[model samples]
Structures are given as C-alpha cells and as structure tokens.
Target chain A: MTAEFWNGTMAAAAAAKQARVQVNAAYPITPQTHTVEYLSRFVNDGELDARLCKVESEHSALSACAGAAAVGARAFTASCSQGLALMSEVMYFTSGMRFPVVMAVANRTLSVPVNIWADHQDTLVNRDAGWIQIYTQTVQEIYDLILLAFRIAEHEDVCLPALVAYDGFILSHASEPVHPLDQAAVDAFLPPPGSADRPLLDPARPLQFGEVLFPDWYPDFELKKHRALADSLGTIRKAFEEFEAASGRRYAPVDAFATDGAEMVIVGLGSMMKTARHTAEKLREDGVRVGTAALRVFRPFPAEDLLEAVGGCRTVLVLDRDIGYGTGGMVYPDVTRILYHEDHRPDVLNFIVGTGGKDITPATIERCVELARGGYRGRVEFWPDARGAEEGVPYTEEPAAP
Target chain B: MPNTHPESASASAGRKLHEIRLAGRGGQGVVTAGDLLGKAAVREGFWAQSIPTFGPERRGALSSATLRMGPEEILLKCSTAAPGVLLVLDPTIWTQFNVTAGLVEEAVLVFNTTEAPEEVEARLRGGALPYRLGVERCRICTVDATGIALAVLGRAITNTAMMGAFCGATGLLGLEPVEAVLAERFGKRASPNIEAARAARDAIRWRA
Candidate 1:
C-alpha cells in the first residue's frame, strides 16, 4: 500500500477510480459532491473509462446505479443528508434486488435545523434498511473500505448493497495520513465487478427480473436477505484478514483499545471513536482504568465482538451521536439487549451527545468515564463537551471549541 | 505538562506537536494560511491536518481554521481547545473570538498588527491582570504582517506573512521547506508569498 495524506472525500473518490468502477450514477450533495466530481474528472481525463450517469436527483442517482448493477456492471454512487432521505426508497429496492451496489455516505443531519455538518442521525435512521453499515475513523479506513465494500457486497455469501459511511465534515474534510495501494495490487485484490457474481439482466440469456412475488414466495426472499445480512459477518472478517496480510495495517469487526482489565469502556460509532480512544490514553496517564471499543462494522453490529471486548470492564459508556428521542441513545438499545441477559455485565451509561454537527471531545469522554465510575446509570444529563457548550451555558471546566 | 512538546532546537526536535488556530476576516486568506502551514509541515516530515470553518462569511465576516501537526500520527478529529499557537490574522478577531480560549501552557499568540507588543497586549488583555489571561508562560509576539503582505504580494493576505512570524517565534523549522511548498502550490507566482513570509519573519518582535 502507498501511504500519503488524503482527506475522506479524496480517498473515497480515489478508491472508486482505482477500482475502475464501470458505472457512476452521480448526484452532488454537500460534503459528498467531491466524490462524484472527482470520479467524473478521472473519466474525463481517460484515467477511468466508465459510464458517468449525471442524474437529476439522488433518487435518479441510486436508480441509475440499480439499473447498471442489474446488468452485471460495477456501479457506485454517493450521497449525504437530505439526498439520502430522498433516495431511501431506492436504497431498499437496490438491496432487495441483490445488486451488490456500493455507496459512500458522508453521514449528516436531517433538516428542520437545515445544517451542513457532521452527525450520525443520517446513517442511524437507515440502519435497518438492509445495507451493510461500516463506520471508519481515519482516512486510511475510508479508502480501504470503499474497495472492501465491493468485495463484501458482491461475495457469493452476501449479495447485497453496502454503505461505507463516515461522519460528514469531520472526516470528509479532515486530512490524515493514508496508505494508498498500487492500482495493480487493488485490481488483483478486487476482480472486475460482476465477473464473479451473477446478474439479472442478460441479452443472450433472456430472463425476467423483479417480478411481483406471491405472498408465500415473498417471505422466502425476505428470509434469504435476512440470512445474508446476518451471515455476511464471516465474509467481512475474512476480507479484513486478507486485507491485513496484503497491507501491514490490520482491521477487525470491532477495534478495542486499552480494554484489558479496564473498569470503564466507552463505545461509539464513526470518528468520535478516535477522540474516545485518545481520552482513554490520557486517562491511562492519570491511572484511570478506561478503554475504548469502536463499532467498525455497524450493520452486523458485531455483537459478539463487542461482548468479548467489553466483558472485562465494570462500567461501559455508550456515547451516541443519534438519540432515540424517548428511549435515549439509539445505539444503546441494541447494546442493552446483549448485556442485559449476561450474569456479569458492565453498567452501561448512555450519553446522547454530539448530535447535529457538535463535536465529541476528549473532555466529554473523560466526563463520561468519570460519571460511569461514580455509578451513574442510564441516560446521562451532563453537557461537558463542545456540543453541549453550544446548546447552553458552559458546564465543564474546559469547554472545548467546536 | 508531560504531554507538551518543546519547540525544536534541532532538526530532530523539529517534529514537535503544534496546534494553531487562525482567525481573521473572510477575505484575509486564513484558511489558505492553514493549508500552506499543513503543506509545509508535511514537507518537513510531520503529519499536518487543517479544518477550515466554513459558514456564512462574506467579505469581512469571521473566518477561522484549526491546524494540527505532530511528529507522530494525530487521531483526534475534534477542534483544538488548548492550541499551542493561536494566530490572529486580524487584530479585531480578539473582540469576536475567544482567541485565548483553550491555551496550553507556554502557548504563543502571534498577531499580525503593526502596533507595538505592549500596546497590542494592553488592547487585547482587557483591563484584567496578566494572570487573568488564564495562560501561564504565554508568549505574545507582534509583526506588521499585513504591511509585509500588502507590500510584497500586493494583497492583504497575511497567511504567509503570519506563517513567517510563526516560524520566527517558534523557530520551528527551516524556511527552506516552507518556500519549497509555496513553489509547488503556487508555481512561478510563489516569489511574492515567499518574500512576504520572509519579511514577516524579519519584522516580528516579542513582548516583555
């Protein structure tokens, strides 16, 4: 792998270009415009000879991808926030057809506030929509995962659409060191898309596609889709291991840092995991038994992996970017189900922080660990980070700038 | 603070961690300054990242960018609270932004004003005592960066000018890499920016 400094937007675009995507059904949205724009540049410059479908709306963008994917062509697209919401219908249909369409989503907030910033609400709202949800923290993961998504999505075991996502501006705009593999290496790793998988549309071998399913037959299709979603976990791990062997960098279902013999564990999705991990390191200096567990693979939820990672901690802090309104943090509900039945479980504190583009700071993570240590249970009430500072009067000794 | 990195006294020491937040009016090239600083850091074999704060900034509206650089990799994506260096491209930025907000110990605040150091401190420090500034071992430096940029580049963009001030105050790294990065990014048009940066470096003075 070639190492270089790349922001998320450039990494995503570069991956698509290197993968030599056959079709790009394009649409432009805040934070995500660069992905398609960059691909279009490559195509125009003769670096990538792909069909560029400059679609009208995000709806058309995904629809065009679905149409292309059905014809056994490697298709890719990207969207964010409102565009994602508009294309929600097609996102489900794309996966239902088992097209293995790959998408990169710069997770942003839904409107009412109408802000263009980083938030988890956008991806969280669609967690149940049959797309493999993978959240990345660094620029390296963003580039690597875009290539991996196609492999996992088109695998014979899991023929489904996948969304390789990251926090919108936080990662999409932030620059970091990335290991960009040679095009020949990437090409060897990922076969020309659809060369391995079967497709519905064929001119020589005529076949009907997406016909109305009878009530009895529909359940079978749904069950198969559900099974693929659950069973894809193994394929994801296998691909990660193979990737690690090729590149010196390793990946896993859940990345745990400083978790061994820890009393407190903080868990989250997207870029905040890095901040949480950094806080754990600082707290480690202070002799605090703190650790971090990041949900690298969100769709499969990595429940077993999370269980093993957090089993040693006495108190687990779940910092959520998307709140469940009346139920508290969105991610907490699923995590609760896993630990509730266990005989020995860490007391989990759910913090609904950093919603709608606010930053989750190391100070905030420290506060949560402190609260969890003090036997704080259920949803948290303190606003000790930059995001909270934006909503009201400063509450922490050091309110970080957002 | 054990975590704090000492300013470079040698080539090996040059990779010290530095977090700089630059604030200025919309047209002042604050974001461009962050980009240039990052490029220079990379050229010097350090990891540099900048996040430009985009908003409804028209001509003179507040535009700020946070820049982070270190010897090793930086993992955190959040904005810097306790910056090692706080750069104010415009003196008026002090009124709107808490320019001194989260300053680590021995932090440097480099101003691009033509005023004397003591006078700028008096105007910037409010009526509060020196300790009330909330920073211990804070070094305040001033330079006529705008004057240098205007004269050399024929524009009021003080990014390169203040960059020179940063290098002079911190003595962070050699100006060779900075000039080289400028040459690459700006091509043949880099001469004026390089001159502005060098002039700003020469014009800087520290407050007692």
Candidate 2:
C-alpha cells in the first residue's frame, strides 16, 4: 500500500467519501471551508455518491442531515464555533431522535471577540445535547474516526448521534502522512446502510419522534433517553474493538500513555494529548513519575475507564479547554463527580490551557505537572506563561498559593 | 558548504527528498518559499508537504515554514531540526531565534543580506554556513512579482517570485512544469506569474 501525505482538509474529504455518505450539508467558515471545498470537488467528480446541500446557515445544514437520516439515508455534515452554536437547537433533536448522523466539528473558540483558532469550548458547550463526542488528535485519527463514528452511531444498542471533532487550523490545516484505506477495503468494512429498524417516518408504523409529552410521560421519556445513552457504552467499546480487528489500529475510549507506576497523571482531550505525551517522555527521562491520558470519547463519559486509569495515583491533573465561568473548568466538575463516588480519589487538580489556541508546549506541560505535584489545590489554575508572554524567566508567580 | 559533486541523475531516486526550512519575519514570503518548493516537487512527480508555524500576533513576529519531499511520501511533520537547506529571508531572524541551531553538516545556508560571506560564516562558526545571495536580488524579484500580480490578478502576491528563486537555485523542476502547476493553482493569472517566474529564474545568481 503506497502511503500518501494529505493535508487534514483533504484527508477529511477522503474519509467522508469512504463513509459513502448519501448527503453532505455544510456552511462555509474559516479553517473549515477547505474541507467543504474538497467535498464539493468529490461530489462533482462522482467519487462520492451524495447530495451536496449548500445551506444558508449551519442550522439548516444539520436539520437537513437529520431529515435525510430520519428517512433511512446515511447522512453527514460539518460545522465549527459559531456554526455549532447556531445549530444548537437542532443538535439536541438529532441526538434525542437517535438519527445516527455523523458530524465532523472543526473545534474552534466560541466568540464575543470573534476569534477563529482551535479550542474545545465550541464542542464542550454542547455537552448536554446527548450526542456521543469523540475528539481526534492527529490527521490520521481524523480520517479513521469518521468511519468509526458512522458505525458507532448506527449501532442498534447505541442509536445515537456522534460528533467527531479536531482542533481547527491545528490539525485541520496541518499536513501529515496518513494511510488511506482502499475503496474495496472500506466497502467491505462498512456494510451498506442496514434497514433502520427505528425510522421516524414509517407509513406502516407511525410514531411521534419529538412530540410534546405531557408531564406524566415526559420524565419517563427523558429517563429512557438517559438509559439509552448509558447502554451505549458497551456498544461503543464493541465498535472500537471491531474497527481495531479490521484496521489493525487500536483505539480506546481513554488512552493512557506511559502511565505505569506513575505517581502523577495529566488528563486532557484533543490535540493537547500530543503535547502531554511529549512532555511525559521528557519528564520520565528526567526521572519524574508523570503520565498522560487522553479521553478520546468525551460523552458517555467513560467513568469506569477513567477511574481505573487514574486509580492509585497520588495526583491527577484535569486540563480543560473550556471554562465553566466562575466554577473552574468543565471537565474538572465532571472528574470530581466521578471521584466523589469513588472510595479513594486521587488529588484532583484542574488547569485550563490552550484556550483559543494559546500555544501549549511541552515545557508548559512540565510546569503544569510541577504545579500539581506541589500541592496546588485551587479550583482552577491558568497557565498564562504558556502563551509565550514572558521569556527567559521561569515560574515567576506562585499561582495564588492554593 | 560546497557542492562536493554534481547531483547524480538518480541521486534523489531513493535518497529521500531533502527537507528545507525557511525562516523570516511575517510577510517576508517565508511561507511562500515553502509553498513554491512543494508545488515544484509535486510537478516533478514527487510527493511534497508544506506547513507554516505562525504566532498569534501576525505581523513583525517570527514565522517559519517547513517543506518535505520524497519519492515515496513525506511523514516527518514537525519542524525540521537538521534541515538540508535553510533559506533565511530576514537576517534579523538569526539573532531573534535559534534558526540555524540544527543543520546537516553539509547543508547550504542562503540569506538575503549585503554582508560578506566571511562575516556570515564567522557568525555561524560552530557549523558550516554559506551566504549565497543578498536582499537586493530578492527585492528585485519581489518588485517583479508585484508587477506581475497586479497586472495579471489585480493583487500583489510575492509567492511567485520566491518560486522563481527556488527554481533557479535547485533546478528541481523545469519552468514549464511549474507554469502548468501555477496555471492549475491560479487559473486566470497564470500567464503573468509565469513571465515573472522566468524573470526571477534569470535574475538569481548562486555564489559558491
């Protein structure tokens, strides 16, 4: 198999083609426009048999995808920061109805100042939408996970929508060598769209998808949705296992790197995992017991896997790209929720870095680990130095000493 | 650095394509240099990849680009440490950052400066460094590119002139193939840029 280096934009389009999408709907935005442009080319060249729906807004894009998927057609769409927010209302419907639509969210900073760099605040803001979210760290993973997302979302036990996200401009524009599967192999791997047993608009069996429920049935419906989401955990793992067996590239909900007998651990999502791994290697060489874990699957939370991975560690640092306003960070609260139930939880620390594509280097990771090990117990600590503001001076401030 | 021997016909057949690094202040055509090299490599029937590293503050800050080429495919995506060729568009970058910290022992260093090669070599003593051309040639090429861009595309983009210098220095790909690529890349304005690129190719002088 000949290896070809593809820019992330091209790789994404190639993956979409491999998924054999029946429809593609998107709105143009910076850093993400390139991917859609490639999709347009693919559609025009007949490489992909799909309807390229040029919508006026991201809301209509996802809505069109939902409508298509509800009618038993495989559907795909993509969006970023403001676009994601614009589609927030329909985003919940897609997941609640269990449409099995896959979306590639180019992660970007949500705005007031109108920034277009990479960040997780956009996707993280949609956490309660009931969508299964998977964050990718590299261009290769971006290609691989799109295929996996379709399978995972369509699984009978996990009939839920899925979002595969990667940092905009960071991974989306970065070029790297990726091994693209042949068309035959991809066709063999993804079977043709199986009969959607639960179609929204079946003439023979009419059912209400998003009906206004009375007070009595509304709580039960919501509980059922929660139960369905919880049941998806098993299906998610099985899909990952099958993908690994076929492709020979293994992926897990939570990936731990160099965490053997480590006293301290750092947890992050998206591209920061790469920085963390590099930092972990450097720290291990210097004889510091530090390890890094990246949560590939954010929704369905993977509570058990996360607890098992961080168990017995003296300290655990939770770094989140999104902040929950006055309450530290988003992942920090979730990690604490899981730790609260455990009999023995490691000293959980939360640090916010890489917000709005602030440069997070290996040295910043090292500094984060040092702070966590030094008994810093504040709710949230920000790595201002990681922005490369002050040079040549190290550890200038004490970080409020708590 | 000196050319020990003329490049063999098949020298680059299996020897992985050389990795080149270009460093300069923002808006100095550093990224353009990498893009031109990539386009030319692709035209020569080789795979190429280019990436830019820029800071938040867009202008006047240090920006760099890396270009990799090879027969099979290029995979090393990070910044090149030991680049085989280093093109410095701004001399100030040498002091502002450690741009020349790592270079292959036999690597050639090209700079846009009026300083004597001896002075440049003295500053880069730990490793062998050679100054091949000055900013005068680059400014001339830039002026030509602006004229071509304005006349052809109604916008002055300096990337074409950098493409010309790359073609002149390396002889990696003929001007005809580059022009074809430029035509495919920039449809309506290919003719003027092709002429500008030819002028740039003719203007460059590689000093030993």
Candidate 3:
C-alpha cells in the first residue's frame, strides 16, 4: 500500500470521495473550511462525481443534507464550534427524521472571546442531540472512521445521523503519514447509498416525511429514535470488526493503552490522548504504573468497555477539555455515574483542562497523575493554574525602542 | 517531568527523534518548509508530523511551524517545545521573538541570513537576548536562503532553500526524497525550487 502524508481535513475529504457521497453541503468556518475546500477541489477536478452545494449558512448546510438524504442519497457536511451551534436545531431535525446524514465536526471552542482553537466544547455540547458521535485520535482514524461512519449511519438497523469528531487544529491542521485504504477495498466494505432497505421519498411513491406527530404519538417516536441510537452500538461494533478484517487496523470503542494491572489510568479524548499515552510510557520507565484509556465513541457512551478498561485501576483521572460551569466537566459526571454501582470501582478525579484552547502538555498530564496518586480526590480542579506555566516558554515583552 | 524523547541523540545514527521549529513571517512560507521536510521524511520511511501554529496567519505577521520526525510512530500531537533544531527564515525575527526559547543544549541553528556566524553572534550579543546560555552553545549553520530564492526563483520565497540547508546541515534526510517531494508538490514549477535548494545546501556554512 502506498502511504501519503495527509492532514485530517484531507483524510476526511478523501474518505467522502471514496464513499461516493452524492451531495455535499457545507458552510465555511475556520479549520472546517479546509475539508469542504478539499471536497470542492475533488468535485472540480472531476475526481469525485458529486454535487457540491454552496450553502450560505450552517443551518442551510444541514437542511440541504437532510433534503438529499430524505430521497435515498448519501449526503455529507462538515462544521465546527459556532457553526455547529448555528446548526443545532437542524442537527436534531436531521437525526429525528432518520436521514442518515453524516457530518465531520472539527471540534473547536465556542465564542464570547471569539477564539479558534482545539477543544471538545463544540461536540460535547451536542451530546444529547440524538446522533451517534465518535472521536478520533489520529489522522488515520479520521479517514477510517469517516468511512465507518457512512456504513454505520447507513446500516439498515441504525438509520441515524452520525458525527465524526477530531480535535480542531491538533489533528485538523497537523500533517501525518496515512496509508490510505484502496478505493476498491472501501467499495467492498461499504455499500452504495440506496442499497439499504429503507423507505425513500420517491416521486413515483409520493410518501410524506417529517410530519408533526400528536402529543401522544410524539413520545413513542422519540423513544424509538432513542432506542435505535442505543441499539446502534451493535451496528457500530460490527462495522469496526469488518473494517479491521478488511484493512488490518484494529479499533475499539474504548482504545486502551498499558492498562494491564495499572494503579492509575488517565481517561481523555481527542488528540491529547496521544500525548497522555506517551507520558504514560515515559512514566512506566520511571516505575509509575500509569495507563491511558481514550473514549473513541462518546455518544452511545461505551460505559461497559470503559469500565472494563479502568475497572482494575486504583484511580481514574478524567481529563475534560470543556467545563460544564457549576458541574465542572461534562465527561466526569458520566464516568462517575457509570462506575457508581460497579463492584470494582476506582476513585475518579475530574480536571477541567485545555479550556479555550490551552495546551495540555505532558507536564500537565504528569501533574494530574501525581495528584491522583497522592490521594487528592473528590474534587474537580483546573490544571496548569498559571497559564502557559507548565511549558517554560517565558514571555518577554519587546524592549522599548532605543 | 516525563521525558519528551526517551531515545538516543545522534544525528547520523540510532533511532533518534528530531524536533524542528521553523520561524518566519507569514508570507515567507514557514509552514510549507515544515510540510516539505515532513513529507520527505515520511517518504524515506520515517514517521513524521508537522503542524503550523494555529491562528489566523496574516501576511508580514509572525508565523511558525513545528516538525517532529522519528524512526517509529510519533504519539505526541502537541507542538515541540524543546526543539533540537531551529530554522530562522527572517533574521529580524530574533528582535521580536525569543527565537531560541526551549532549545536543547548544543542544538543546531539554521539561518536565512548573509552574515557569518561571528556577525550573527555579535548582533545577538548587542541586543537584549534573554536566555543566552543555550544560544551560545548551539552549532550555527548560515545560508543566504532568501538570496538563493531570489537568484533561482525570481521571488523571495525561502522555504525550499531552507529545506536544503536543513538537509545539508543535519544529514537526517537525503536529497533524493526531498527532490521527489518537491517535484510532486510543485509539478512543472519544481525545477527552480529544486535548484534553489541544491544551491543553499552546498552554500551552507557551519561553525561549532
């Protein structure tokens, strides 16, 4: 196989082209603009036989995808932070309508200070948006998961939309060597758009969709959608297994590293897990039994697999890039609730870190491990209390002109 | 603190991880230099990653890119803080930025300047440069990359020339892979950049 250097955006666009997405509608946003730009280039070069929809706003982007998917077309879109916030309403509509529209979200922080940096706030805020959410740790995973997302979202058992998230700038802008899957392999692994046995809004059939249900009927439909999302875990695992067999790259919902009989395991998401895992290896050299468990799939929650990864450890240090105001962190509560009734539960500590695009250095992670090992517990704390202090790049103001 | 790199540190031998920071203005192709180096390293069967500093890059404003290359997969996704090599595309960058911040001891410095090592050191000594210990010990490689670019490409883009200097001074990457990467990226326009790189590589002056 020929390996090429591709950043996360190029990988996502390549996967979409390979998946044969017929309609792509997206609005331009920082970081995420590159994905759609690459797709447009593919379309212009006649490499991808797809129609690029030039939408004006993020809401219209998803609306256009929903329209295309309602009629048995494989539709795709990409967005981030504020753009995702704009598409929040359509996100719910697209999921509830069961259109199976797959979106690639370059996870970035929200505004107020108006920053464009990597964080999980954008995707984490959409945790309850009724879509299957997955996170990626590397550029290769970005490509693999995008292809897998199309298959899982289009699976007959799970006709729900999905979001493939990678850290905004960390993975999005960073270039790495990725051995791309062959087009024929991807074609064999993923079926065409209309191949699934689902109802399509054909002009000959004239079926109605997105009709408002009465109060009593609304609850049943909502419950069914929720169950379909929860039950889609089976479909996700099956797709992962098949993709692994076809490509020889193994993936799990909770990708664990060095978690065998460890005293402390750091739980994190996105690109920071790479640094955390490296730190764990270095700590192992220093006789510290620290491991890392990254949550690849966040929406279905993957509680059982997460527990299995960290159940044997003495302490679980949860790193959350997005804070939940008074509650501290978004992932910490879910982790605590999952281990609440387990027989072998580890002490969990939450650290609100990397908020507003702060760098999560190895030193920052090492500090967290030390705290957990030193019996610091039962409280959510902020890391690197002094900004940019963990990394010793001293700030020096330019001297006044002589 | 965890060891950033827990391997040996020899330029020509062993499985060592090299971290390089390319500092330049936005219009000077700093990010593209890192990109070419990374792609070349990957082509030579080494694990490589390069990322531009995240922000809105305005022309004439300060911009930088970081590159990491090793014999195995690189797990750290963050930018390199303690780089073993620093490439300065604009000599004026030394005034506005530290330029040598977090550099490892006895590191390598590649400059896009026409001055010799003595002249460059005299200038820095005259200025108020903080943390002079590491800067004093670093081995310096001087090449007029901008002059080479101007002479070869008729433009002020120094990325290709800087890439050549990096390959020449470090011997970490061969010229064949770098030429292949340039030909693939620039297509028919690759001839001038390749010429500029070859000139800069041969013209580099090194001092311990």
**Winner of 2 and 3 under TM-score:** 3
Q: Which parts of model 3 have CA positions greater than 4 angstroms off?
A: A385-402, B1-14, B122-127, B130-136
Cα error of candidate 3 at position A234, Å:
1.2
lDDT of 3 by residue, B1-208 (tens): 1111112243442287888989989888998889889999988888999988866779978888889899888998877778888888886776677777778876778888988966776666675665243455667768898899999999988999888888777777867889999999999999999998888888877653
- Report the lDDT of model 2 for residue A376: 63
Error of 2 at A125 (Å): 0.7
Residue runs of model 2 more than 4 Å from their true location after superposition? A384-402, B1-21, B24-50, B54-63, B66-86, B89-109, B112-208
Best by DockQ: 1
Per-residue lDDT over A116-167 for candidate 3, one digit per residue giving the tens place of the 0 to 100 score? 9988999988899999999999999999999999999999899999999998
Q: How much does each candidate deviate from the true structure in C-alpha RMSD? A: 3.6, 7.0, 4.6
Give Cα-based local distance difference scores for all models: 0.80, 0.72, 0.85
Once superposed on the true structure, which residue ranges of model 1 sit more than 4 Å away at CA? A1-3, A378-402, B1-16, B128-132
Q: Which ten residues in a row have the lowest lDDT in candidate 3 chain A?
A: A393-402
Summed over model 1, clashes come to: 2
Worst 10 residues of 1 chain A by lDDT: A378-387
Best-matching candidate per TM-score:
3
Question: Per-residue lDDT of A181-236 in model 1, one digit per residue for the tens?
Answer: 88888888898766855756889989776679999798998898888898899999
lDDT of 3: 0.85
Model 2 lDDT tens row, B20-120:
77777776666766765666666566777676664464766777887777775443334555566666666556755666545666555555454545555
Complex DockQ, candidate 2: 0.14
